[model samples]
Target: MSSETTYAVEFAKTSRAKCKKCSDIIEIGDIKILTTTTGGRFDVTQSFHPKCYTLPRKFAGTVDDFVDETLRDTTEGQILPKERDALVEAIKTSSSATKKSNKAPGSASSADAIIEKIKAMVDDGENEPQTKKAKRDDHYSSNEFVAAYRVYQKEKNDELKDVLKWNRQFVSGTKNYLLVKVLDGHVNGRLARCQLCQGGRLKIDEKNCSIVLCNGQFDEDAQQRIPCTFQCSIEDAPRWKPWFTEEPSEEEKEKMDKLEADATGEGAGDSHGDLASMKKEAASLEWNLSNKEGIRSATEDAIGLLKKYNAKLPEDATKAKQKIGPVILAHKRETPEDIIAALWKEVGKQLSNEEKEQKDKALEKTTKVDANAKLVAAFQELSEYYSKEANQRAVFTYSKCLNAIRGLDYEITAENAMSLSKGKTKVEGIGTAFAQKIKEFCETGTMQKLEEKRADHA
Candidate 1:
């Protein structure tokens, strides 16, 4: 990998831009990281919000390796010391906030506590110079670093005793270690280091060496380990290959060059703004599949784009759906209609199990009520549990039955309801199964199977 000096820079955005990774709007004044690339077919520039920026693969495979290069501080383009600390704190804060939010009801106090924790770290720098220097140099030496890495590698095997408990795994292509051939005292000079603090250096002794991190710190003489707050890890790697002597190509070189955009990639002509508009429109509209004309028209539009874009509906869309991204990817071939239909499907799936059960039970109890009210109740229950065809059937029966009964100016009793369900006189939307349910309800004052469903739900 190329030296770290060629990697990334953090700068405040002067104007609006799109986050290259998420393709979302990055408003003006947001702190963003701009990455530079050169020697490519085009001198491509991509900018990311700090949260979204990952050390690209060409820089270093693992966070450990990235830290090593960062600590080397051999070049100006690399992240500076203070910036590096801020980035590390940002990542830690984000992780901590996520865990806390998942486990408890997040309040302002909880958020304040996290801010204070980070603030405390920042204030620690104000200590006496000697104390600060001791803290700064508090890292592992060559031997202890390697030993910590071995401990990290051993922990992967569950049966191993006296091994560190593994907490997390890095994504593929980002691991720090690979199996490498050893020569002399090094695996191509890829030394181990403090993966957490990124402050120490360690020598590689074994051929199949894995990178390790330790929480142990050292005094100024670097003789003995002392307790350090930094947690240890053998993250981003299990094995590594010997450092290659091959020179990087133009593409690889381009990846190494860290450049920021000369100007924000947003303005009057920006597509992100248009996507935002579409997303807002989609959200403003109510999602209801029972509206046949509305939903069918929307679905038809979506189906057309589905074919054009060759995309499938997302597996889980209820949590938060990004309609505009896909629509934009489709080259704006889609309209808000497609988004509406997609959102409707997501809304349907998101209906709670408890809500569905309640609807089912209530549907049975309401069968002897007003014919129009009973059919509406049935349709609501059907929408929750029945197949698409069944729901459609209920929709049709509700509309047609209500219209016929109202046209006759008759009260919704058993005899009047049966008129719409019997023989050749059947209503246009009344199917066999639905007609049977109506007939049974009219004569017996209840639908038997619906009552059974109510019992099961209860």
Candidate 2:
């Protein structure tokens, strides 16, 4: 693709301007006229300061293909009045050829699709609809999907990291290997490096490839390697490819390298800021019906758990029965804890031994952080198993687990909890009142059983 020597530098428009090729904004001052093949069509022209005009750079698509220097270095006094005609003619000729190529049936529909997608821009205040299109308020939402994706990205990025360094030996009789750099974070294996005095990153240099790691004097750390650290270099370093697997031009490669480098620091050639922002913008990601089906399939397992465990109901149990679904649904609609409570509350005890075993297995998959508390709470709620003292222990356990997870920076969500628990087994849906009640119960922790049982047990 053709490149821009200077950015098109958009200016705020005073009023709209219409041209044959297109109708768009016209600003107060057009400091430079961006050089384009379309000549003065103004419609397709890139408005810029004339001083910035030059031929667009070619983009080949690798990390080292292009570099931007001074305009004077490429084109200076070549700006005689006649020079404009030549540049414009060249642009028109090139653009027309591209148009013709794009129109060819065998050659260009795929290219057009990519071009259109890239060119898509929402007008200010307009939002593009996301796939599933629904947003989570409490964000306990599709915690399952998020969990799945984190795994997916981790696996995906695991395929690309390869930085190695070697250190020189001070004594001629001692050792003779270059230190190659490695990483421990999997994604960021390249952090601080040290000289061979301690641990060293080492790699074998092939005949005539690129050279990022150089043989250097030993003093301090510059890079490290895998054998010493948990994080290791990726066995194979493959080229980065677009989704379509198109090989980028040298210029494109350089662009990518710059962007990646900007995202990573000198010691670490990784980038995360842009990707994070994109994920934040794409937060509306959701799964389709298959996930819902999986949830349904897990119910028999949950039912078994209910059957094995002895059950008890409070004096107000009938009220819970009537309002449980709605309370749970409300909590599911609001907080994560309620979802677990509803799940725990709904299934009645009536299982065969095998059924109970299956339910336990299901709980393993659903064993998420939020669910852990709910499990303990559910256990404690059954006054038979939990003496007043056991109930207090339950509260302490829940608090400790939550604190520990937060300290370790792990997500504590119903879905993840459920996934970790019994094994993805859960009722299809929790209704509004049921979810709400669970949420209210967790928040208040003022259920009567604890107080009454406290006196009975003590």
Candidate 3:
């Protein structure tokens, strides 16, 4: 056989090969291209979906020249006329996109010049509306409050106590209570510190409507402590910065307003309003119970509320269904609270088992060094590159493949790399495209894809 490189196009015989560009699996019978490069005693072949195939820049020839070369004296597979045309069009489109991407910003191209003219016309306010910029605030919405509460719930009891102490809030409560208190303080704008006096701070007074400082001096005449008037919002405090950076959407704002109104008994006079409030509260508790760390406390709170309003619960509300793991835990003959309790138990078991498995896998990874460390690093680099490009699918595929490679106990050599994807000991996430990449790295000491990525970034 001639010691030359060749390319051939054919339909995929199996659904094992992944597209090089997209990192997605090509279905069986899809048009694919195989490039074979012969060097010394070993021949390496890489497969790609036809649309993903890019002509080598080193090949100084036209599309027809490359096609002629591909068609010359090859009997293994033949490219159909229509497929050949598609291949040519794909190459041209890929090349055009590559060139456009490679061009720097503000480059003096005809396309850029036209874009500049359009941008200039828009900048001159020809037909654009003069809308005022919306003012931004640091108010936490319902979703943000829930998310922040989950994070706070994950902290240790001692740490949560410290946080409450720092904020001068109530330090005596269960972990869930502390979590909810801290989050509510920020969300409701009730947590504040007096800028006038060092000893001045306020606590939530559930019974009274007056604002009295916790450490303020009591007056015998007024029969009340002096109120602090220089209070400042602690929402932008550094202590809460990590948890509450997300801004709420307009929908979240409306939901939060309604929830606050319900909490304050704004429209609880009618039975309909009372029932609606209970359902909303139950839904909020359900969301909180979704977090594994808050399961116990949230479940207790949920059970208490259910007991209080169980008789008022509608039939459909009591019969609401929840999916936990693979099993659907429904309220066939039980109350809504019973279904919730069952969900909590099932989810706790599943979470415990998952945590154990994760710990075991982490231990395994630490004990055994990756035998294909270089290849794993290359794939990791590609994953990061795809992530920077906002190619989420490609990033996920490469990340999964690299993680699988990290778990390999044996080295990937040129001899065994090809069989590693097909043999009984096949890696879980390695598709044909990644297996070929492994073989290429083992033989050439570098991946062409990685090199191209480096070149592009450079």
Candidate 4:
């Protein structure tokens, strides 16, 4: 046997390609794993689908170690249980065969010797071990609001134990203000709606110790005495700073103290407290909203509205339908009039467009076009604009979305867009956040952030 061994592993998000291992088609937008092996006089590059990738003999560790080290950069299509099992079995089979072959050469090699031989074959000067970094779950950098909200939700559901995951979630000194966070899910770059009065968008006061505030009518003086619904930011939140571990400055401490004081102070009186109590109890009270009869009636109403406006019920609306009960309960409404009123309001918002536009070049850029086309164009635009090393993550995400949409075999209408936008969609590479953008594109015919990007790039 030669003293050389293979030393490289790589992966990429790319267009359709055939898998070298199985001769099966790796569809467009799929993640492809590739490996490079170079011996004394031979070098080969092998490509495989994630599931098809085998444990390489030239690598330095076990199958699990290989996955952690080589595939750390991959964002989609992680190895599953079946694949891991298959890879492990295949590795054992190969090892047995290699020993048998070596036995004929009057050679006996220990496992450690073989491992050392393989490790030494890599050209260390060319391939440096990549330092592992924490994955950025908050793509839009909502100041960890997305992650914090997830923690808050899990706590609300009585999840057995809280698991601190994201680095941002470890942000110190967050004053958890009890603002009803509207637009609670992904809709990144879009402001959270103030659930109290819908007066203004919710914002994180990064400068004020992670307090939440209603941009519409927040008064800092009234924060402690009344339910001013002000948002706050977490002071000394973890970031890529030179001295991030340093404690908060005296001025920062003052801000945190003020924000904490506001969160516990009694404002908005008993009514506010009652509403908070109701919200806490909203999930537990079984006021009969998920019943078949109730669902049937609501479905009928929804279908009628769809028909009246020549619209169709989105597949994603199932969750929204389930939420109908909670929505009514959250508002503390028990009467039929109150429930029906709430239902109609939501229906009307979805069905009607409150904006009008005239024909013009600028209008064309901002006007609603086919949802699919808009999404593809928006992603492409983003990719081109963020074509730098620092922006690779953003570019990769946008490109993945564009490819996913292009691979869609059916028409991308508003209904389909709405359905795809739901967090539950099973599309590869596209998650809840991307889906929210797709939904926004379909609903508004244009995304405000994408257009802003266009202007900036132009």
Highest TM-score model number: 3
TM-score per model over all chains: 0.20, 0.16, 0.26, 0.21
Model 4 segments more than 4 A misplaced: 1-374, 388-390, 421-424
Instruction: Give one digit per residue, the lDDT tens place, for model 4 in 40-115.
Output: 4667666666565555656667766765565443434455656556555654565566567666522212222322
By lDDT, the candidates rank as: 3, 4, 1, 2
User: Could you give the C-alpha RMSD of every candidate to the true structure, in order shown?
Assistant: 31.8, 27.9, 25.7, 21.7
- Candidate 2 global TM-score: 0.16
Model 2, span 34-86: residue lDDT tens: 32343333434445333322334363332112112222212344345365444
Q: Which stretches of model 2 miss by more than 4 angstroms?
A: 1-26, 34-43, 49-55, 58-182, 186-458
Q: Which ten-residue region of model 2 has the weakest summed lDDT?
A: 171-180
Q: Give the C-alpha lDDT of model 1.
A: 0.39
lDDT, candidate 3, equals 0.51
Write model 1 residue lDDT over 41-108, tens digit each, in one string.
55666766666665543543445455445423323555566766776565445545555666762332
